[model samples]
Target: MESQQSAGSNMDNGYVSGDNEAQMLSSGAKRGGWITFFFVSATLTGLMIAGWGWLTNLIVYLIEEFNVESIDATQIANVVNGSINMIPIIGAVLADSFLGSFHVVSISSGFSLLGMVLLTLTATLSSLRPQQCETGSSFCHGPSKLQSASLYAGITMASIGLGVVRFTLATLGANQFDNPKDQGIFFNWFFFTFYAACVISSLVIVYVQDSISWGLGFGLCAAANFIGLIIFLLGNRFYRHDKPQGSPFTSLARVIVAAVQKRNILLPSESKDYYHEQDGTSKTVATTPKRSFRFLNRAALKTEGDIHSDGSIAKSRRICTVQQVEDLKTLIRIFPVWASTVFLATPIAIQTNMTVLQALAMDRHLGPNFKIPAGSIVVVVLISTAIFIALLDRFLFPTWQKLTGRSITPLQRIGIGHVFNIMSMAISALVESRRLKIAHDHHLQEQQGAIVPMLSLWLFPQLVIVGIGEAFHFPGNVSLYYQEFPVSMKSTATAMISIVVGIAFYVSTALVDLIRNVTRWLPADINDGRLDNLYWTFVVLGLLNFGYYLVCAKLYKYQNPEEEVER
Candidate 1:
C-alpha cells in the first residue's frame, strides 16, 4: 500500500518529502546516520582518488630516480585509469545482485587500502634493492624484476579498489535518505561533501608528499579509507538498506520470460529455458543470437505500451509488466540527455588534464629562498574554491532558493554554472596567448644578453577564474546527475557521470595523438617553454560546452514529488 503524506512531505526540488526528508536533516537518528555516512564516504573516496594523483607524481619522480625513460609513464597511467574505469560496472553489477552498497564499498575500500600500502612498498623496496652499477657504464635503475612486478600488481589492485568504491559510496550515500523527493537536498550535500573531501585531500596530500616519506603518503590514503569504514560501521543502524532486489540479469531475464509467456515475441522452447528462474537463482543465462533477437522484439513491444481511451490494452500479450516496462522506457528517453553529458564534461576533464598540465608550465621561480612546486597553485585554488563554495551553499544558495520560487535545483545550478566555466576558459586562453607572445619577445631580447626583465605574473586571473568555475560547475554537475537518474539505478547513474570523464580523457588522448601525428603546432603553441595549445583547445571546448548547457537547460525535465498540489 502507498503511504499517506504527513506535513513537510512535499519538498520543492522533488527528491524529499517535507516531514520524512526533514527528519533526514534533523532527527538525530537519521541526521547522524547520513552525516556519518556521507562524511566518511566522501573523505575515503576522495583520498582514494587523490592517491592516484599522488601515485602519478611519485611514478614520475621514481622514473627520475631510476633514470628510466619518461615515456613508460603512459603504461602506468593506462593501468590506473583502465582499472579505475572497470570497477564501477563490476561493483554496480555486484550491488544489483549479490551484495548491497555497504558490503561492496567496504570490500572495495579494503582492496584500495591494501593496494596503496603495496604501492608504498614499491618505492621503499626499490630503494632497498637499488640496482648495482658497473664500472663506468650506463646509469643503473632501482627495483629488482620481482619488485617491479609487485609494483604493477599493487597498482592494479589499488586502481580497482579506488574504482569500485566511488560508485558504491555515492549510491550508498543517496540511500541514507529514505524519501526520493528530498534527493535534491541530498544531491547538494552529496556534491558539496565530495568537493569538501577533495579540498582536504588536495591540500593535505600535497603536504604528505612534500614533507614526508612516499610510503606515508599512501599510508595516509589507506588510513582515510579505514576511518571511513569505521564510521559507516559505527552508524549502520541509522541508515536504511535497500537489499539487492536480486541480480539485474535475473530481473531482466524474468522480464524476458514474462514477455515470452505472453506471446510478445517468437522464440523456440530452448530460448525460454535460460530465463526460467528458480526462486532468485538461474540455471543458465545464455546470450545467443536467436535469444538476443527475441529479447529485442519483446523489449520493443513492451516499451510501446498499447493503451486505449478506455484504458483497455489491445495487444496479443504483455511482454513485461507495466512498471518494469516504464522504467526501461524512462532509461531510453534519457539516453540523449546522457549523451550530452559528455559535452558538458569536456571542460571538467580539462581541470585535471590541460589545466593541471598548464599549471606545471607556469613560471616556477618563487623569489630567492622560496620555491613554488609545479601544480601547487592548483591545490591552493581548489582549497580556496571549496571554502568559498561552502560559504555560498550555506549562506547564499538557500536564500536564492527561497527567493527563486521555482526551487534552485542542482540541475538548474549546473546549467547556470556552465556560463562561468566557459568564461573561465576563454579568459585562460586569451591570457595564455599573451603570455606566449611576452615570453617570445623576452627570448628575442635575451639573445643580445639584455636581461628582458621578469615576465609579470599575469596568469593569476585565469587561475582565479578557473577556481571559481571549479566551485560552481563540478559540484553542480555531480548533483544534477544524481538528481536525474532513477533510484534503483543510482550506481549506474554515478557511473554515467564517471563515464563522461572517461570519455573526455579518451577524447583528449585522441586529440593529442591526432596533433602529434598531423601537426608541428605544439611547439608554436607553447608560451616560452610552457604548453598552451591544449589549454586553448580546452577553452574553445568550454564555449561549446556552454551551448550544450543551454540545450540541456531546455530539454531537461524534473521529477516532481509533491502530489498534493493535484489534490
Candidate 2:
C-alpha cells in the first residue's frame, strides 16, 4: 500500500519508478523534516567558517608570507574578493538551468575542500612561499611566478566553490519547505548563520593565524571544509532536488528576439488574440495578455503558424508567451536601480581594501595583553552588520510598522542605506585627515614603515557606519530584486548582488591604479603619501552615487507591493 501511494506520488514529480520507487519515496518523504535543517545549516556554517578563515585575512597572508607590498597586497585582496563573489552568478545559472543545486553545490564543495588542502600545504611547505622581507627595506622578495601560481590556484579553486555555494544554498534550503512564511524565515536565518560563522572565523581563526602559525590556521580551515562537505553529502537522502528546466536566461532572450522580429506587426485590441503561458502540454487554456508593455505583446500574438494540431507551438523558434514578455519588461524596468548598485558599492569596496592598510600602519593595541590584528579589523564591519540586522528585524522595523501602520519598502530602506553610505565615506575622510595630521606632527613621513600614534580603532566608526549602511541596503537590494524579478529569474535575482560586488571591487581596483598613476596622493609607503586625500575622493564619489541612487529609486515602482512586507 505504501509503495502504491509512493508510485502515485512519483507520477507528480516523475523522478523514478518500478523497483526503486519504494526506496526513493522513503527518503523523499523525509526531505522537509525539521531534522534536515541541522544537516544543511551545519554544512553551511562549517563551509563559511573555513572559507572566511582564510579569505578574511588574505591581505595579511599575502604581505607577510608572500612578501607582497602593502598597496599591492590590498589590490590582490580586492581581486580575490571580487572573484569569490562573482563566481556565484555562474553557480546560480548552473543550478537554475542545468545541474540542480545539490549536484553543483556538492561538486563545488569538493573543489573547495581540495583547495583548502592545497592552501594548507602552501602555508606548511616553505617552498610554496617567498622569503619574508625585512621591514623598512627598499626591496621585497615577492613570490616567484611558479610559487604564486600554486598559491593562487588554491585560492581560485576555493573561491570557485565558495562563490557557487553562496547564493545557491538559500534556494536549496528554501525548497525543503512549502510555506512562503517558512521560506522567509529560512532566508533570514541563512543570512544570520553566515554572519555568525564569519564572526567566529574572525575571532578564533584570525586569532590563531595572527598569534600562532599560518599552517595550523589553514589546516583548521581544511578540516572544516572537509567536514562540511561530508555533512552535505550525508544529508543527500533528505534533500528535495529540483529538475533543471534549462536556463531561464534563454527564455528571456527569446522574448527579446520575438518582440524585435514582430516589431512591424500591429497588436490586436482583443486580449483573446495573445498566447498566454502554457505549462508543459496540459492545455490549461491561455489567459489574456496583461496591458502593460503592450508593444511587446506582439511577441505572444498568435499568427497562422503559431499553433500545431496538438496545441503546441508548431515553430518553436522565435515565439514567446505573454508572461515571458512581461518578465523581460520587469527586468528592463529594474535595470536602472540595479546599475546604480555598482556605483553605490564602489566607495564601500574602496574603503574596505584601503582601511586594512590603514590599520596596519596605525597603533593596533588596546592594551598590553590585547592587540588587534590589522586584517581582523574587517570583521568589525561584519559584527556591526550582524548586530544592526538583528536589531532592525527584531525592533526597529516592527516599531516603525506599528507607528505608521505600514512597513518600510525595499527602496525606502535602500534610500536610508544610501544616506548612511555617504555619511560613512565622509566620516572616513575625517578620520584619515586626523591620522594624516598625527603622521605629520610625529614626522612619520621620514620613517618608511612606521606606525602612526593614532589608534587603529579610529577606523571602527567608519566601518560600523558602513555596516549599518549595508544592513539597510544589502537586504533591501536582495529582497527588492528577489520580489521584483520574475519567478523564472529568482536565483539570478539573488546572484545580482554578487555581480555588483564583483564589478565594484574591480572598479575600485582600477580607481586605485588610476589615482596612483595620476597623483602623489597614494604611494607604496602611505606614510609618505596623502592617504586622507584618497578618503576625500571616496567621499565625493559616494555623494554622487547616492544622488544617482535617489534618482533611480524615485522612478522605480514595486512590481508586487502587496506580497512584500518587512519580516
> What TM-score does candidate 1 reach?
0.73
Deviation (Å) of 412 in candidate 1 = 2.4
Model 2, position 371, has a per-residue lDDT of 88
Give the candidate number with the greatest TM-score: 2
Give per-model TM-scores. Answer: 0.73, 0.92
| 405-454: candidate 2 lDDT, tens digit per residue | 98778888888988888888889889988888899899998888899999
Residue ranges of candidate 1 with Cα displaced over 4 Å: 1-35, 38-86, 127-148, 180-182, 249-318, 365-368, 442-460, 523-530, 561-567
lDDT of 2: 0.80
| TM-score for predicted model 2 compared with the true structure | 0.92
Candidate 2, superposed: residue stretches over 4 Å from native: 1-30, 33-35, 279-287, 565-567
- Quote the positional error of residue 267 for candidate 1 in Å: 21
Candidate 1 — worst ten consecutive residues by lDDT sum? Answer: 1-10
Q: Show the lowest summed lDDT stretch of 10 residues, model 2.
A: 1-10
Q: After superposition, how far is residue 145 of candidate 2 from its true place, in Å?
A: 2.7
lDDT of 2 at 273: 74
